[model samples]
Target chain A: MTAPRLDRGQRPDGADFPDCKRTFMEFNVLPGARAPYGIRNGAGPRRAVAGMVASTYVSGAESEGAYTLHMLTGAKGSGLPLLSHSEAHVTLYVLDGALELVLDGQRYRMGRGDSALVPAGTAYGFVMTRARTVLMAYATATALDSLLAGAPYDGFIPAEDDATGPADLLKGDFPGTTVLGALPEGTDFAEALTTLPETSVPYVLEAGMGERLLVADQLFTFVAGNRQTGDQYLSVMTQGPQGDMIPPHKHLLHDELFFCLDGAMRLKAGDELIELAPGDFCFVPRGTPHAYQFLRPFTNMIGWLQPGIFEPFFHTLGDPTELTRYPQTPAPFRFDRVIAKLDELDIVPLGRPPEAGA
Target chain B: MTAPRLDRGQRPDGADFPDCKRTFMEFNVLPGARAPYGIRNGAGPRRAVAGMVASTYVSGAESEGAYTLHMLTGAKGSGLPLLSHSEAHVTLYVLDGALELVLDGQRYRMGRGDSALVPAGTAYGFVMTRARTVLMAYATATALDSLLAGAPYDGFIPAEDDATGPADLLKGDFPGTTVLGALPEGTDFAEALTTLPETSVPYVLEAGMGERLLVADQLFTFVAGNRQTGDQYLSVMTQGPQGDMIPPHKHLLHDELFFCLDGAMRLKAGDELIELAPGDFCFVPRGTPHAYQFLRPFTNMIGWLQPGIFEPFFHTLGDPTELTRYPQTPAPFRFDRVIAKLDELDIVPLGRPPEAGA
Candidate 1:
């Protein structure tokens, strides 16, 4: 709530932010939302291939898609085609340098703050080698009709296990960010736009997957990213103090904000144990009871809700990769009749802080 | 009214025209305003004395005085560094190429849609010759204060009347972008920041001049630019079906949204003309008495109310060497007494238009 001066203090209220007279697609009035009818920048593609530069500013989008941000410069080193998808659940934030997230064939070097998961159909490849600049926020996207529920999976792939051709749905290049046997198995999404590389296309923003969450660098994307317009997309996840402990728990529906930007954040929510820093901020609303930890070393910014793309609970951590405790049951959509459907949408989560022997 | 799709469509509710991730500075962000800020590549000192390639995204910001969006790309016959400033009021738009400006010593060129005004003390310089790209918006300035009512004039020079070294502001750059021009009898103002150019310095974003009426790209800035949150920035200037005139008009409290991004737009407002097209959208608000013109070739996207930093009525132009011809008259702030103080903040306009000679 601070925005009033429009330039009166003797100068500088916006000299001008550009519009040298026409760019291209211009419209988005902002009330709640509406943007998706674009062919986007491949502007003119026939195919020449390599010059690539993928994602660059991915911060949590709204919850359903949790903390999503993308950024990838030019395309040095090499190795990038291959793709597949069932729906997202990713998380890879590395701001300002370093890359090599291979997965499926194995590579992983990631830098900055490191956090990874590439589930769905598995088949990924990223090689920047050095010229790095990253941020990738993909929380939940489970809905492929509840993720291929009946199973059988086959969005297409038989034409003799295809090999290449057809793919540029706005730019999927080798089946998007690639990985699927690297390529050769009925391929065909137009061979992911014949290998991409005309340049420009990129920029595909979407949100959903429990809504999205990732505090420290402001990846609070979609505090409620939309079950259909519940509106929520606040990103600031700077990858701060991930001192990781997360012991306390409570969430009847959802309520939180833990706004810290580096070191300091104890937040027990509800009855309060607060303890914030870096310009502080807190709330954790809903049925109240909450949980969080990281004192000796911290990095804050939380904001919750929006299906919270917990991505099937972090893909159950690559299938029980040593469950770090905390489970008295309660974690599949954590429903209690959806807490009376989120207190009729007023949302309510004010519980958990009085525990240490309340 | 259409962005719900979050992704069964994979992604497409952002970046079609996407820009407002939280922008108050950085070229500009007013379609639903959202500017996030942070851009750097470097240059400025005669654009690095003159190798050029500068990049600044936006300037004059920080809690107050904010308005700056610069982008200078060079290569072919480079140019930039013949500056001038004093009192602000500088505007230049042309996004992906075409600029030759020069000023005071004369030259002009510009491209895209074109708009030039560098008054305050004049003496500019751009010259990209070709590999160009321009989108400069200034603010918190004083130079063209609606054509200097505070008076001062005469082509500016006295920064020391030409003593050699240091005054390149950008080649033949004396007190570049000047303002007021006092002290021929000596010179002062703290030696004008020891010879300016630490990116010029000055920060503050929203301080005064609010009350909305901003629409860039066919120009029309600050009307209700937020007058501290009274809210109302309208636009819509259409015309067709053998009808569209708007010659005389008044009412500047702020509010107008002519919309119609492509055809049909027989607008007028006060005397009535109406018609609008495309996704349609009208408001007018404030005291009303609008204006518009277009018997055929339509494309409306107005939305202007007033936000400040568009040189209070473009330095009330009268001659920056001449080119003028827009709406003019009603200078410094007057349009139905600022629309009667914006009808005590209720805001209205877009009263009639259901069809019939609309």
Candidate 2:
């Protein structure tokens, strides 16, 4: 029998590039790709908390303490108990399946793509009503890390024999969090929304319910924008058809992140060209040159920009509309509009690099 | 408190498409995107088998009993005992991290991107030597499904207190499988290969050591091809730069599946457009019009085509090359050459549709 041959690449670990210190300035997360600041789907520090698998994506350290992003995945019947984060502003956005959200004792059933924001100290819990459900939780402060940092959980479903109680799982010294036991039984769930609401005390936006704007060929639905979050951050959902969407540009203020919810996105960050899949993430710090291309139909993405200074970039250029999604035939993009506001918006466009792979 | 508004889209589930019968002809899988045949990453039937979390990606039932694909992820020290599949030819390809493989009494150390094929009834086992290691196992028949179908494993790492022994975990009547206890200790590992080997009995190819070819702007590396598997299937790795890489075309002879390994891929299958992220999968059956574009720098994808009759499509159009990765500057694509082989290759070119979003 002939001996097997194994090719060793440049790196000792057979990685293409030598290990470099993680700057956290720019990062990409995809399968087999590692980033100091992000986690790929299915591979992260995970924990079985309350009945769901919580996977930490962006930790406080990775984000330089700006915010933390974690994904909560659970099957039907799995859920979180009522709890309050005294200091963290928690944003829960459902990606798939349905969720019953109990916020401040008022129940609401959230379907796919629904989102809610619970400000500091507001109690909330959720129950998965559908299987293979996914929820993304972004906290303005570290929330799940202190609870999930130990050994990784080995399974996706909690064992039937698991004897650990809520008290045991809630044993961390995280001052902001307060567990309020299980969801109340026999409570009536609030009626589903029909159109986007004018305003609510504690913000909640159902699927396709948001401030809609047509910017170029893309539709921007700001689930949580400057007015919604009190200038904390901007959380928006974008969907559009395929094309080279923008020129290379840099933000002088505010770090931004792109979390792909669906479709395909090709992004250029600094000198690196990256493609984002569903659940993939790319972080571009301020001053880093970046551009994005929607490469396929219905390329959907979620953007989280910190400090909420750039919300006007969309509002200033886009025409506010009632359409929930981009039009079948979109209006031509006005590049001149973006060019006119570049300096005022802290956007510096770079001349396109020699055509890629030329 | 003001009442909220939820935009109820055309579909009751808030999905873009109305429920349609799954024809198993074309499917796309990314985050939130569901396929009738494939499982999204982190969302599939799973089992804790031999200390690793085994996730079923493409089951035999989904593949029409032709083959099965599963992903095995483990932490350091997690592994399988020597086992043999009597009826299934198992191919193990490492996506990330390192693994110690014991094949027919010989131990081999495999790093990132390494792969080995264990033919039917060949005893093989593996131990994860690095943390967060992931291995993709593709079998010529149903192998892991019969082993991992009970329930989803609740965690990423196995529980320490679990009492289920090997015999208990291996109790299924899977005719082909035979467990051989734990890996033997004190065994020396074979040295890694520096250069590509001429040939081996049971095929093994390390990362960057496959049969390399340059077709247009993309680099095609055949880890397992027609000759390698006796015309069973062709497994290839492709990397290229950003561009509209190909015209809309249909394959008349083979069913192909694309799994995004790294970077971004925008694929058009029939009328649907899809962007594949890492771990995302898209399956296009024969006679379906399909096209693909690499939308970002270093967009990488792994493709599996069954009953491999189309290996010549690449070999005929590509020049043999020594380089392992796509070059910084690629040779321009010869579309005329592709036009020349249109009928011979069973490729029917469809004129591009109107520019997207026009």
Candidate 3:
């Protein structure tokens, strides 16, 4: 079906349509070619944390609700507060040094190349046994944005004092999170384990070529992180046409990772511009502003988001149409509506929309 | 440290050491060149089930513990027995058509591009909704050899009747398997779901370059299937030097799968000879005689085995040195001991050693 011709005056919503179509039409536009939805680079704004640093590769906004991937470095003696994600599963793969995790009065130590999985509803806290770098993946049915509420937007968490405890750093009555005052006394930690029905096993759903959603201007196939998998995390493959870009934005909660499987793209994470090719990986930590632009005809990459609560954002805004053409005009979009959703998902826009700024 | 020189009469064990060292010594052997210890190739044997055909791509012998990968094609109306593995987890990804799994008095239907994970100790059976092709992965702490004991050596299973039940096809008291005569009455099918401890989450271990083991005539890095991961099926990456070959042998149980990542090799599965290159895949089913010879400087591939029971076979018979060089002489091995272990694992030799035959 032909897309409706976008005319600003005809639509009373005052929604803005990307100028890509106009640019293509002005040239010798190829028939059946659709315009790219938007461009997003891996580089965006930067945020500094006290005694720790994190760089995100993919963000909840980009993952369309999968899992978040990030690289976190904890300084010697640094520790995160005791916290629990009531609806998220967190995984940590130590890349260097050692990490000590305190869970329900039990202590576990993980060294370099070691991994640990913390199921949802488990109260846990972690301290760096030494200076450590870790790859963290948080998978959940809820959005990380909500779970990370009250976390510092920038700068290191202030040193703990007599009046303040770890829980003071987190804000909001986030249903997904519970900051433990202290290890519960006489608590049966085993009761927190996830239980499934006897006849039920973990189910996997595969999305074929014909199954895809057009979110933000890219075509995506959900590989994991669905309701069937208990929304542990979201894994997806995305294809973006050349010139597609996403305006600068940052996620308050959630990390994102990208593996370029084919094609090329230019990523902007903070002030750094990274040009990625096939087989390259990029991590974007929470609170790091980032954007990207496809450099070739089309770029394909695998993206994951942590605490996969943000997936519904795409379903709410994206079109479930098969992507066959490029350079086609986008449907009119209300910026206010888009921004409203982003705000709820803890996504902060750092710049004007591409069309508006251009 | 230098390897001890082989003296035919010095060792009391009649196990024959490979002549690879002598052959290298006769030539201009490169100094410090070590030998490869891992064996990885997808081309192996073929097996026929009643109304179904399966070929293994990776075997536990090559995976170093993690998992076995295989491809199975089912006739339109074919079904497997109501069986369960107490120590292995099974995952099935439907590549084509539909499949109906009967588990715990419940029926789950999966279509193309669908997947299901069957936890250990769950009694289940399956029937093809139509002519179907599927990729199956069996992850376990035990080796698949014991679970598949006493099945046919060749040809399809005879149609089931009152006199011959599905349980009769299996021999030996494999602790992992329990074939239900009929769906148990008042069975709490929900109890079969996999449950993890509160502190448990899936763990991943990474094998580095220094962690490889030499077995047979190849170098392998264990990718999965180790005690750290509870000995789930083994996944390993192997590199074989040029001219390296394994004599024809057959496993009575378990399947092997291979994915050629680099170089080339010639594989003999039963009477069929197939050449493989990068990106090629081969599956060797249980009971099919197979052997392979590396054709180029070196061939690299990924191999996996189900149940992982056969991994000990390599440790028991092959050298366990860190691979430092290529085209190094293989330590001498006693075929009688090798055969003894093979017999216990349900492996049968079909031809003489490569050097003796050459």
Candidate 4:
């Protein structure tokens, strides 16, 4: 697409905050946007690092949204308070040192190779264990796009400064704007979000009637999972093991696409473990038991059911009804009735592996 | 979209290799997909270094595409025949050695910081000056997608009896199968691309009009450089020292996106002199008077417009037009009504840059 929109010409009526209480900047990550932080070339670490840095690259204000790659770094010991979001789901990527994480009555030492998903209405905190760096992102889950447009958090910040004609964003004086497109000086509010405690109860997921989840790796990666129709999830996963008997399972309602990102991977339909790799793509017919895992770790770019994201379901536990039926940690066998009920919901079993020892 | 149709269904059409004089089992840098090739996880190195050995990660037709990363070491003095790509353009990413580079009738010692783009259709060679590792990448200027799909290449060579299956790919193997979902093993062709020699040359660009490109980093972090409507080569350039004047030079009809990747830079827009860093993004409006140089060995990412893709133009430039206007070698400013002729063929600027910048 063309560059994203960058202008916020006029403030919305009644939504405008008093200029005195505000310290804000209006910048978009789109092309041709102004650099607010006044980053001078050949000056300080900015020059040593070589190139410009974004003002703010983390997504806050929305709790359960999926975050994007945060290509940014800042002063050590930088942190924020425990900010809860209402729409998007939040997943924190610990890039360097460990982090102190606290969710509803839970505590965990989250270091590199560790990730946490803060669901909507969930309380979360992040404390830089030791000069920690992470990528925290999320997208709208319920309120949909309207919520993305109407972000609820609005703290008063200034657009222009007194001593400085316009806030020198390239030089990092941007306040309020957690989304700094120019001098993306991370917001102090982001620092406020680090007050979370540790861990609480463990949450596990189970397959329900028409439920399509296959297997998920804690929060690290989702190996094999199904999605409802109209749901979407973008993940870079490696394919599965060969003929790994993935019992017939289907998305009660959803379409699916698996795009190979790296290495070579195999996709198993009914009896097919079709091979795919970078740039090669695959699709799943809704209500199909499609299972895939590579012989090796082939990066699989998976795009599952759109309009309704399915990543959350992977984190959430299954309903009690299915629990009563399966009543097991890892279901011993693929239940036929349960799968049939799932198929009725438009979630159909794509196919099943050959009988064991065959 | 449901899983793509991937059943071979007894069609068995693959195996007709077009780029036929087949070669395999060597490390390579693929066209457009050039990441460092090291030994696969746990795979031993070909030879020991400091304390580690040098094992080849990319091992296929595409693996051999990666020349620099897959520095194979079998017996002493067992360097493989120089495998250079004639179909696609290539550039070297020198990680740990010096490469003898010859370009345009000149020889240059290209080490870590030095990179030379081997234009398509050019005679390029690499001579190892040190026992070091380098990263070399190639980008096809035009007909790249076709080259990726239709080109004769083997994605991987089974590691001498290694029996893991292929990764699931998006490329539908049966060209005639429209609704057919998954692809056959031939899809591994993408990952098969790797390493090329570093017989570097000056950078070049080419692309069809209206096509936008978001060149992403290894982790898929991408930046924008494509054009939009009412766009000009000058429009994207940053405001120089004295207001945003790039001088009275005529718009050459070709624009460029100049982004500082690392280090320090010196830029001239109109009569102003400006410095640059890695994060600082700049634009060189075509047909305008603008010039820049790395005052302190800065690495920059430049996207050229009008000419479209970079590799094709460099490869096609057997006899490049020179400009007598500029006060330097390979002068940056030129008056080529020829640019206008190229523009008429639909290779024109797209949209205007924002009054602001990304």
Name the candidate that leads on lDDT. Answer: 2
What tens digits encode model 2's per-residue C-alpha lDDT throughout A257-308? 7888765666666655555656767767787777787755446788888878
- Mind giving the per-residue lDDT tens digits that candidate 2 earns over B158-211? 433333433444455554577766777655767544343443246556554578
RMSD in Å for all candidates: 28.0, 22.5, 18.9, 21.3
**B160: Cα error in model 1, Å:** 36
Name the candidate, 1 or 3, with the larger TM-score value: 3
Q: Is candidate 2 or candidate 3 better by lDDT?
A: 2
Q: In model 3, where do residues sit more than 4 Å from their true spots?
A: A1-135, A138-257, A260-358, B1-69, B72-256, B259-280, B283-313, B316-358
Segments of candidate 1 deviating more than 4 angstroms:
A1-358, B1-79, B82-84, B89-94, B97-130, B136-251, B254-342, B346-358
- DockQ (Cα-based) per candidate? 0.02, 0.02, 0.01, 0.02
Instruction: Flag the better candidate by lDDT, 1 or 2.
Output: 2
Per-residue lDDT of B1-358 in model 1, one digit per residue for the tens?
Answer: 1222211222113232132121212211212222222121111111232323333333333212323334343432345445566645354433323445555555554433233444444556555543223333333332222221211211111111212222233233222253222112111111101111212122111111112232111223221222221221111121111222333344444333343433234444443333443323333434555555433221223332333222233223211211011111211222333344443443333433212211
lDDT of 3 by residue, A105-193 (tens): 56654443234445667667666544223334445444344443333322111221212323343443655677665423331222111
How well does candidate 4 score on lDDT at residue A79? Answer: 37
TM-score of each: 0.24, 0.48, 0.31, 0.29
Evaluate candidate 3 by giving its C-alpha RMSD to the native, one decimal: 18.9
The fraction of correct interface contacts reproduced by each prediction comes to: 0.00, 0.01, 0.00, 0.00
Q: How accurate is candidate 4 locally (lDDT)?
A: 0.28
Residue lDDT tens for model 3, B66-166: 44445454444454567787666765544344456676467665443234445666667766644222334445544344443333322111121212333
Which rank order by TM-score, best down to worst?
2, 3, 4, 1
